[model samples]
Target: METAGLVLAAGEGKRYGMPKALAKHGDRLLVQHAAETLRAAGCERRIVVLGAAADEVRAAAPDLPETVVNPDWATGMASSLKAGLAALAGTPAIAAVILLVDMPGVTAEAVRRILGHAARDALVMGGYGDRRGHPVLLGRDHWDGVARTATGDRGARDYLRTHDVRVVPVGDVADDHDIDTR
Candidate 1:
């Protein structure tokens, strides 16, 4: 099955005083880093969800893959997730590996590890020892349920909690530390 990559980079980053997608990591913007990470991880297709400073992000990262702007981004991360998933609905991909733009520590290797569990019925997440984290793999079968439960920054947490989610330990190759501040 073809697994697509969904980058959720629409947050306004209230804590950081700017949009996290525009934040710089090394020489690349966080959103660029996110899309590149997914590409390096071998996702057959990639889509970025932009919000807040959508025009600025587009102008800054002109080479990014397909992008969808979430009109309700001010609401929360859930809106971005919904937008990304909705954009992927027409694709041939059977699953999507979800990543957050602010998480610079989640490397391509970690995403590749999660991609191994991609399936129409799969619900997998990366685990850091005992703590579950980003790069969650959501199969096509659960997209509807995830979209339904995704609301007010919860994203897919509510749906994952009620389902059987396979956790793959990727701490050895990646870190889940998110850049929430300057």
Candidate 2:
């Protein structure tokens, strides 16, 4: 299926004391890493939602991909998610792999695994052992409902809780840890 990469990097990172999207994981910025991972995993197009430090993040990773600033980002992740989804509205992609900039541990292989199992009628999540996490694949068929229920820091989480999500264990291929705190 044709899939797009949606990176939610607009958070102010209140706890981290800075924009987490600009946080460095070795040589690459967190947002850059996430976008690159998505590209490597086969996203036809990559769209990033920037808010906290939009210009700085863009300057740091100019070639990342298409980016949009979430004016309502102060509200939370839901806004960023909505912005990214909106950016993908007119694309040829049949689905999108949702990624968080704070998740530097997520690797391209994990994304590939998740994409490999995606279906138009189902939700696909990367599982780290017993816990399902990032790189959530939302088929076009379910986008509207997901967007409707997404709010605050709970982007798509509530919707997924009420749906049957297909999990692909990727513990060995990637880490599911989120760098939300110091």
The most accurate candidate by TM-score is 1
Query: lDDT at 141 for candidate 1?
Result: 97
Stretches > 4 Å off in candidate 2: none
lDDT per residue (tens digit) for residues 28-115 in model 1: 8999999999999998699999999999999989989999999999999999999999999988889999999999899999999999
Candidates' TM-scores? 0.99, 0.96
> Please, what is the whole-model Cα lDDT of each candidate in the order they appear?
0.94, 0.89
Query: Model 1, poorest ten-residue lDDT window?
Result: 43-52
Q: Could you tell me which residue pairs clash in candidate 1?
A: none
| Model 1 Cα shift for residue 159 (angstroms) | 0.4
Local lDDT at 177 for model 1: 92
